[model samples]
Target chain A: MEVKLSLFGFGNVGKTVARVLLEKEAFFRERYGVEFKVVSIADTSGTVWLPEGIDLREALTVKETFGKLSAWTNDYEVYNFTPKEAVQEIDADIVIDVTNDKNAHEWHLTALRDEKAVVTSNKPPLAFHYAELREEAEKRNIPYLFEATVMAGTPIITLLRHGLRGDTVGRIEAVLNATTTFILSEMEKGLDFDDALKEAQKLGIAERDPSGDILGIDAGYKATILHCLAFEPITFDMASVKGIVEVTPGEIERAKAKGKTIRLVATIEEGRIVVGPKEIPKNSPLAVESHENVAVIKTDLLGKLVIKGAGAGLKETASGVVSDIVMAALMMR
Target chain B: MEVKLSLFGFGNVGKTVARVLLEKEAFFRERYGVEFKVVSIADTSGTVWLPEGIDLREALTVKETFGKLSAWTNDYEVYNFTPKEAVQEIDADIVIDVTNDKNAHEWHLTALRDEKAVVTSNKPPLAFHYAELREEAEKRNIPYLFEATVMAGTPIITLLRHGLRGDTVGRIEAVLNATTTFILSEMEKGLDFDDALKEAQKLGIAERDPSGDILGIDAGYKATILHCLAFEPITFDMASVKGIVEVTPGEIERAKAKGKTIRLVATIEEGRIVVGPKEIPKNSPLAVESHENVAVIKTDLLGKLVIKGAGAGLKETASGVVSDIVMAALMMR
Candidate 1:
């Protein structure tokens, strides 16, 4: 089946996805058996779409020079319209919801009601209204995948959702946030918190404002998602756990003396939410993990299933987005 | 659906599988929507099979006492046969193959040909003829999943098979053998190679002969499986890689003092087969992974799909067997 997609937001993830599709367009159809067309791209700059189709390379080069796609002046029509209305009328098999809109709740309700299966790198909807969204999806029998929203390209969400359907998991302990972990790791190496934060910012590991990542809010949202997926009713919010941006360099040094690392660990204990910075053994999966590496999940039957890899990056995050798209495609009727 | 299974080998992995089925009976059915039942078990001693299904707990107890099922002297007809034949005739929806009969490739061939989907913990047949078996499975459309065969219960097989299907991977680097890695880790900790090997043997991480795990043959088999899933044609064999098993404790100490660890690594470079020991930084994912933990594959697209966990444990291996059973049931048309 051919997929006509209207991609919203041409950020790092979106650009990488576009590039990957363009590079492997032929290979995917020939080897893996997938066909996709990114017909539209919309961002805050404005919307630029080709009804017939647009060349990925040309659009990419234009965006690089002009800073935003709206600057590209071609024969393509510029239907200055809100993204919500545009998505409904797009005539697409799927909609790539990569918008910067924080109100993911609105997107899910709107796009899903239109019978358009959504594949996103967004975190808000799953964090806020997992139950309602899942119920609606079941009723509609449509797939809503957010593999990038949690662990970038790690497939943590899919691992919990589909792969672990039959497994018995008592709890999941994860260092879901890579930015904070990276900052904390650098801080342990004698770099002050502010300097580490600056380094993380330069590396594009943290938010522009850095508030969501620094305040533990980002990791907290992931915990909520993980809790909902692994346990039940992801009412567990990050507010329950103390955020880590306030931790001083002195405190980090104190912890390091004992051969420990301050990691943002999210776990379910007796069906309750447990999220905080705990002292993990240096040789433990969590401590050894550097940069944006995420690890440490213990299940009832499988015991400890430890995984470490890139949690966030242009390439890694794009990998997650691609995974969601593929999964939604597979589940399509 | 009730899954009547005829379990063979009655070894660590086999016994662990039986335990998971008995304990997680309700969880499996309610969660996965499938019921599991073990009808017959075979060991060298004798056979204990209940046409109606015997008590798993009592059967295990009987096996422990006699070292075989024949010690019980039950009134029911005892059919002494290889698990291969038992699978063909026994009324079973799935066959659990956890036997260590490596050269007995015919056993795997017979089981799959009989229309009974196989879930194996053994790497023998898969290493020898993965393509042939996969072709047979394609013709039959039954899932012959061996997630445990590579990184026990880490979902590496699924990662390669389905998770990253849409992406084109350039290369894969892995520490596939747990026994060799364990011995090498201990050697780095000041123990000589002989002492480290002895410790591994005592912990049951190493076999009595220890050739397969020690001489890199175990990793070789796993690499072949990875090659089959990742590359085209899959022509490499155990003889291809420059195997590493004879490093001394002094070398391990030298590597460690320089803030690195020595790991016997198997890697695929630009579609070429490569395997050997190399020094890794202290914070590398593979360096931090110790004991029975296994980490493998740094794909070009999906960076470090590192799965670290109990590479080979009785229950973990058993859980994988049961997982394949549930999948086989789900795949039923």
Candidate 2:
């Protein structure tokens, strides 16, 4: 089976995903029995459209060398095409969205409407327009997977969706944002909020405009995605989010005095979805180290299942995207 | 799609699986778009044959009350048929092996040869004959699933096989046996090994003949299953195994004094598969509480993925079995 793909966004995560696809092309073919080809890739400048399937290695090198797909002289570049136009015009089996662009969901929906499967690491598409996108894909009988949205490549979403099938999930507690967790851990070590944020940003774990991560919107988006998958469908607005921006050094010391540490935790239950800085026992599974994500799922039958791993990183996020691509391709078969 | 099942066990795990399947019948039908029916169930005494579908609740009640499926008077029973005969005679879309019988693999192979999917919580079948069983199922293009074999209901196998599809696993360190973990934890609390074993047996966490749990054979089986899934094909005999029987109270106390606890840990690398008592930091993710299992998988790309959950218990084991059944059913569809 040949699974052709159109990629949206040529950012770090997108580029890493392309690199992984290229590196694992033969492995994917041998293991999953599917040939994956990037038919088109839409970046900020333009779409590198190749109906014969883009050479992923050359495309990645071109983007890295010139910072734009339009600079690829070896390919026919559609300079006027946006992601929406690329999705509408490209002949592909799947559309992979790794863009942080707010309008990524439009192209995602467009792709699904055209009966193309969708795999995304982008949060907003799922955090806000889950119902529309999910319904469109379901109506078209195509897979719409976003495993990397919540916890990079840790497989929490797949675990909840498939592994725990036939079991009732009671509640979910998670540390969703690695940036907030990293900052909180640094704060526990006596660093002030601003210094901790600066450290995280310096480490490239936080974005230049770190408001989304520091103000709890990123965790809120993840919480919303998890809530929709584990329980019901709800947009990001349904979740109540509180960030770690107000956490003080003194508060960290006070928590330490009680053998506890403050973590930015997301709690999802039957009727409640909350993301906030909560003081938890230092030994709690959710009280993971810096950059690690943990999810504690309480199931009626299986008790609590705790999963912890690297939640965010270029390679880990790409691992998740590639895993989802393999799944989507297998389903396409 | 209607998925017919032939159940080949009636012990605690098997009975719990039947109950879960019965309770979740409506949910499975509505959610998975598949109707699951138990056509024939072979226990110790004989086979309860129901061509249409067994009344699962009634079957459970009969087995619990009479201790044999042959005592079910509501339907005709095959008195002389063993599991082998049952697999050969009865028609089913999948064969669910939850039996501990030494010859269970024979029936499993028969089912696969008959082009029936196989879902098992049994360890010996896979730990001893994984190559033959897996090859048969692969040749038949049917799912031969054993999620419940390693860490019951934890989703570790699925995570390795599907969730981490494109990534390469470098090593695996796990607390695979809940019995040993519970015993060691109890021993750490000042109880003798015999007393701890008796307590575990009293709590139904260990079998009356608890040699498998105490001698590290149970953990070895689980480790072999995981090794085969995560890395390569190797039987239980190929892996080095050492039991916890040699560990003393003094050793446990000394380890505890060092902020470490002795756990029967299974370490699997490329060519090394070792299961025995090892002292690990108490704060380590693999140092889970009593009756809990944890697997720390170090992947080449995703760092270490730690999964911890109830590794043993009737309900948890049944959750794993039913989850595999659902997966096999989806594959059959």
Candidate 3:
């Protein structure tokens, strides 16, 4: 059976996902016996519908040259359809939500209720409305995979969900945000807080409006999602979040003098979620440098399972979304 | 659907698996919607058959007291059957081969031929005849899962096979054998090679015949299996094996003086598999300490994904086998 995919975002991640799907089309067919086609793609500007599967190469070129699907004058039909309307209208097997829209909760619900499996890199719906979406997906017997939500392409979600099934997880200590970690590493190198923030922004690692990252909201969101998945149901508001905005070079140096380093650590233990700058031993796993994200999951049976990788990137996150698509397809069979 | 599992070993790992299955019966049923039954169990002494599923609690009690199924004079009948005969006769959906019998290759083939899915911690069959067994399992449309063969319960196999499906894997640097790693770590603490081996043996970390581990043969076998699964098809002999038996404390101290640590590293790069004590930076992922295993997987899309966890333990290895059973059952549906 061919898997029909409808993408609800046309940003860098969405376009990179499309490129990977197109590039690995043959590999998927030959290895996994899965044939996938993107039938529709929608962005903020417009929506393009092609029930017979859009030509990925042409769509990529069109999107690269003209930043919106509405500008494409190909065999596809362009329309002014909202994400909700696109989900309701698109006849596909899966809906991929990569848009950074915080209010795509209803769109995801509609897709799940319509019997379309949902794969996403977006975190808002999962952070706020995980229980409802999970209940809907369970009721529909479809997958609601968001592997790219936390550590980009790293397989932490799947590892915890499926790989370590028999083990009881005790605690999770993680560095989930890349921007905050990068800033702190720079601070350790004698750069002041402002200079570190400027360097991060210059490297495109931090956005102009870095409130979500610097305020610990992003890591709190991930912690909330992880809590709902791994431990129990919890909302983002319940987490005790403290960001790296208050971390000064003097404090970093003080910790360094004591053989410790300050890192933005997200932790979930005993039903308490905390995301803040914590001073850890220099050799601790949480003291990872630069943009490297690490999660140390303490389990009863397997000890601690440490996974580290890139926390944020266009292709890295796209790889996770595509892998989820393949997994969803395989599970669908 | 109820999954019927047959055990071909009554050793520590196998008994621990039974205990875990009995313990997590409700969790598996409620969470994964999976109901599993142990239909048959066999050890070197005898075999016990139960088509309608044996009482796991009683079996555990009897095995704990008597050390073998043959001594259990309960409601079940005991018969003297070879592992091969047991696999051929047992009416099971899956056969779990956990026996340390290195010559149980024919029994695995028989199980596969009899249309039973195979889950194992045993490495001999895979280290020798991976392609043949894989071909047979594929021909029968059954899963031949051996996640416990490499890093016990740490999610390496599933991570490489399912999680990292979209990325192109480039290189793998790993510390796979815990005994050698433990010995090396002891040597790092100023013990000679002989004294370190004696310490490992006293701690039950190394066996009396520790040639397989000390000679790097164990790591070589794992490298072979990983190579076949990840990179390409290759036998154990194809790998360039170097043991840690010749690694002296002098060499370790020399490396330590240079800010490096001696670790028995198993590497697969450019289709070459090498297992030997190598001097790595003190903080490298491969420089894991006692009983801890680490794998650094380099991929094109995700950069390097590092995973570290317990490499060897009865419960840990059993956890991997049980997880594979659950995954196989889920896939069967």
TM-score of each: 0.88, 0.95, 0.94
Candidate 1 local lDDT, A1-333, one digit each (tens): 677777877877788888877887887677646787777887677777776667889878877888888778775565676778777667766678766577766767677777778888878778888888887777787877777788788767766765554467776777888777888888888888889999988977776798877777777778788777876756545336766767788889888888777887776544566667777878776664554556566776577776666787777888778767777776673
Candidate number of the best TM-score: 2
Model 1 per-residue lDDT tens digits across residues B124-232: 7888878787887778766677777877776777766666654667777778777778888787778888898899889888888998777777777787788888775
Model-by-model DockQ, in order: 0.45, 0.77, 0.71
Q: Which has the better DockQ: candidate 2, or candidate 3?
A: 2
True lDDT of residue A32, candidate 2: 72
Q: Residue B149 in model 1: shift from native, Å?
A: 0.7
lDDT of 3 by residue, A1-333 (tens): 699999989888999999999888887898789899899988887888889999989988888898887888657789898898899988999999999999988999999999999999999999999999999998889989999999998999889877888777899999999999889989889998889999999999999998999999999999888888788777898899999988988899999999999988998976799999999998998888876899999987788889999899988998799889988998787
Question: Which portions of model 3 show Cα errors greater than 4 Å?
Answer: A74-76, B33-35
Cα distance off (Å), candidate 1, residue B29: 2.6
Residue A134, model 3, lDDT: 91
Instruction: Please rank every candidate by TM-score, starting with the best.
Output: 2, 3, 1
Give each prediction's root-mean-square deviation over alpha carbons: 3.4, 2.0, 2.2
| Cα-lDDT of candidate 3 | 0.89
Indicate the residue-level lDDT of A18 in model 2: 89
Q: How many Å off is the CA of B238 in candidate 3?
A: 2.1
Highest DockQ scorer: 2
Worst 10 residues of 3 chain B by lDDT: B228-237
lDDT of each: 0.73, 0.87, 0.89
